[model samples]
Target: MTETRRSEIPPTTDPRPDQQSPAASFPSADGLRFRPLAAADVEAWLELVVRIAAFEKAPWHAQRSELEAAFSDAVNPVAENSVAGVDADGGLRAFGRVVKNPGGDKAYVLGGVDPAWQRHGVGSAVLAWQEARAAERFAADGQPGARARNYVEEDNPALRALLAGAGYSVVRYFSEMLRPLVDVTAVPVPAGISIVPWTAELSEAVRLAHNEAFADHWGSEPRTAEQWAVQMTHEHLRLDLSTVAIDEAGGDVAGYQLATVDPDVEARHGRREGYTELLGVRRAWRGRGIAPAILTDAMVRFAAAGLDHAALDVDTENPSGALGLYERMGYRAQRRSMAWDKPL
Candidate 1:
């Protein structure tokens, strides 16, 4: 649920195609070289991410294909919006990327340095480059009230300190929750509602319903068709395990639950987990038990598929009382992360 969507900014008269790469102006890092990342660097980037995850005791890691797909993204193509710091031996030591939301109101700074390279100013250099890139994008769009954002694990004091020093303040907190699949219970669909298996034909409908359901959530923006297509076709997405709830009379989508299972994460952790990547109930459909019914359906399907657990992330202060609902449904908080922001 914490996943974000980026959209193409409005065309600018000054394309600045020949402008220098942000990496070219990055702060100096001893014995390191900086450059924009490319498709060829996906493998090294995945390795770097895995190393950082292990060092930080993080529960998740990225797949190589995900990194490759990031390079192809039109909104923030790696060749243009990414910077990689490499050691003398050409090993990736640090990296940064800036992804702007569809409305140009917020840009996310995503990257980290290898633990071995920490305290050597590599992180600061990468952060500086990312912030500069975010500012440049905001200026090009000429939007007011734009800001740069970053999410850090609650346990990561170093990165939190870095952001604080750079004038960013913590704005929100999110919790990663996990529910075991043992003794799962089924919840009947509320009267006049039908829960159906997710189908390719219903993808667009689900996306629209999603946008509407999240319209009032903090920091949410509508996902364009292009952005929704990318998520719908992602390698880990499991339509077979996903479900959609429809209003019996109107036949409109009332709620949905999109599922995913990352084989790489399963292999690394030695357990199968069905991730509820996105779940929501339309505003008008709230308080009808649709959310829990869909969640129970997913847990039933996940258990039937031999998955060990179900997982999801929710904003700590979700207006819909999502955290309370999850807690009541047997989910326990496994980890926490903080969102930090700085006005552009």
Candidate 2:
């Protein structure tokens, strides 16, 4: 649930997009000074994310390429949407980004602090700064009721405490699932449906079908063309390995399994992982077994590519019984991530 969203903060002279003045930098209780993250800081920022992940024993890992893409205009357009805390030693201790979800109904604040700096007000300052930016963006749109959300690992008590003390309430839970690709069995495509390799020409139809499929899911929103383009052009998107289920009768995208191969996953985990990033079946195609067929096809493709495993994230409370379906398809829970939110 630590996914990036497009922020809508307006352009400004202030280094801190949410703050009234450029000089009003975020100051920590210690000597750390917060500043807007720059293009040059991508590597160090990714290192901080990896550090926190290891400290928290998170099953999923971060990649510099992914982080770089997220900070670009295609994802988070607001330059000041992200903040970083640097120590006198020239090390980044904490970071935060206020990303506006596609539909603008909610803004997600995603960040983590060095364990050593957790109780010294670093986390609090980063969270407050993110909230300020989100509030400013919401007010600019004249939507005072917009919500700001934060997702944290269930085992991270410090983060949970900071969020609760800041007035955020638990809203949902998500599970990170992983499945070994060895001996993956493929499921047959349903009648009147065909599984095809993802193509640039069919990207729009696939994107629209995905949004329609998840329209009823919690916090779901239709993806803007800009957002959809980001995924289609993603650095690690494996177009050949991705599966698109098309309804032959109507020539519409009925279901899809968009997979990715992170260059850093093997380097960090000692094994290659093919991530099933998005798996959805349109409402008209639900209960037709299209989802599982598409998902299993992706796994089979991963195995054929010599990958060690497949990974995906799912909301545990999905009304479509998605969690049960994934488990039945051989995916097992690897870790838990939680989502919390408060109105802006």
Candidate 3:
């Protein structure tokens, strides 16, 4: 999905303390010039994301605070991050950003162009420049391979065409599924199934379990305890809104469903949505209905908190057939977004 304020979970820049992304082509284009984005560009950049999402028929709920957080070291022009464009008539008409590249002998592309400003040699120039920058950065560190790779949604014909025409091919596919809070309940816990809140005392355990669950995910990255603390301790967080399923006797995280109600989301969507952002069941715990059970708990909690709905994304073709699960629970298809990439 396109990076929205709600889905700003950026790819990890470096998986470990010793890893890094490569610099690229920075290959100069004919007319379009490359430049780093300024702080003032944050507002405009976010607006662009919203407009593009709408253009794709998936309008996301983003907040001003989230936008401001985007232009920082975490999201800005680090070796792993990029912002490039040209000023026509003293104003920006085109823009694109590249996320962290998976550093190796091969290179990766975590970037995209505004559809409205496509063609006219703009995208090519920008991409060429990125390749140059990637190569340059790698040279500074004296590394090899670092080839660039990117993933495109199978259903996004437009992006598929653009990347293919530009030398990119579909490599992998994922599904976006949802879980409706319809007929939610605090179902009776099976003998070993225990509901646990991510309280201050359980933070470390919860974080460890989350990391383990996502370890096999494509492009997974390691996160430090401090980083987990930073997010869980957000000033606006409502701890009561989250639930982590545990194996009480085994002391392991089996399934989890973290919920949130962004003020911006509620205001924009005109409904109190108890958004289920992260819902997962460990690989070994699958098929026992652990995931649906956690989701149901979230929906019921949200309903009790005055929420109108609960939503989440699942890879369309997940072995789990997550889409069928949500559909059975009353969640509807809302929108879709795509990604495009080419090797350097």
Highest TM-score scorer: 1
What lDDT score belongs to each candidate, Candidate 1 first? 0.80, 0.74, 0.57
Q: Give the C-alpha lDDT of model 3.
A: 0.57
Question: With candidate 3 superimposed using the best TM-score fit, by how many Å does residue 161's alpha carbon deviate from the native?
Answer: 3.1
lDDT per residue for candidate 2 within 197-308, as digits (tens), equals 9988999888788778777778766766656765566667789999789899989888888888877778778889988778888888889998888888888888889898
Model 3 poorest 10 in a row by lDDT:
1-10
Model 3 segments more than 4 A misplaced: 1-32, 61-80, 86-90, 101-116, 132-158, 178-180, 226-239, 262-272, 283-288, 320-341
**Predicted candidate 3 versus true structure: per-residue lDDT over 199-228, tens digit per residue:** 777767766766676666544444445445
Model 1 scores what on Cα lDDT? 0.80
Whichever of 1 and 2 has more lDDT, that candidate is 1
Regions of model 2 farther than 4 Å from truth: 1-27, 74-78, 101-103, 263-271
What is candidate 3's CA lDDT for residue 242? Answer: 84
Better of 1 and 3 by lDDT: 1
> In model 1, what is the error at residue 148, expressed in angstroms?
1.3
lDDT (Cα, tens digit) per residue for candidate 1, span 1-344:
23322111211122234443443376579989988887788888999998998898776655554666675566676767888898899988888888775445788888889999999988888888787888877766677776889878899889899999999999988888998898777888899999999998888999899889887788776777766766666678889999999999999999999888877667677778999888889989999999999999999999888899998888898888999999999999988888899986
Clashes of 2: 0
